[model samples]
Target: MTTQEVANRYIELEKQGRWDLIQEELYSDDIVSIEPDSAAAMGMAKTVKGIDAVKAKGKAFNEGVEEMHGGYCTEPIVGGNFFSVAMGMDVTMKGAGRMKMDEICVFEVKDGKIVKEEFFF
Candidate 1:
């Protein structure tokens, strides 16, 4: 699949609360995900290395996101095997109501699976 397609699939998996969907289909064993600093996640963005680490990151995000409303993607661009996207999330942050967070994600797909994921805010 194309890079934009890979990135969109990740969003879809998270929306469905199907983190397993990503692990089983899209991820690389050495996947690395960079998480940005936000109210829910404090400190500078950090990278989670390996498949296990990536799953932990997803759970960490889920801990903060009690509910998801709706969202969209824009500026989806691809170069080489990497797809980058600018996305916004309309989410309920745990006890907080709705909040919007702008994020940029770069996904590297190899052999039809995502080998890397890096995000920024």
Candidate 2:
């Protein structure tokens, strides 16, 4: 798939809250996920290699979220083999209380599969 096609599929699955399916279908086995430098303070690694590790990171976050008040995912902006989305969520964390989290999610695609995803706040 081209970047635009991947972006569209990502948006569609995200709207359906099916990120797990997206990962399974659209990501490469060696996909990498990167968090901002400051995320280390939150117990997230600066970079995670492999699709399984990426899913584990997401699972950890989900486990820590007590409730989700709201969330939004913007239409993707396609650029060559890359795409970006502006996403945010309001949520209550297990021990951190309620917080509004906003960030830009950028994805890189190659050979019709997502190879990398990086988050910036």
Whole-model lDDT, model 2 = 0.95
lDDT for each residue of candidate 1 in 10-117, tens digit (9 for 90 to 100): 777766757698798789888777665562355333767899877777777778788888776775577889888787879998776788878887888987789877
Kindly report which residue pairs in candidate 2 clash with one another: none
Clash pairs, model 1 backbone: none
Candidate maximizing TM-score: 2
Residues 74-93 of candidate 2 have per-residue lDDT tens digits of 99999999999999999999
lDDT of 1 at 9: 83
Please give the TM-score that candidate 2 achieves against the real structure: 0.98
Worst 10 residues of 2 by lDDT: 51-60
Stretches > 4 Å off in candidate 2: none
For model 1 the local lDDT of residue 35 reads 67
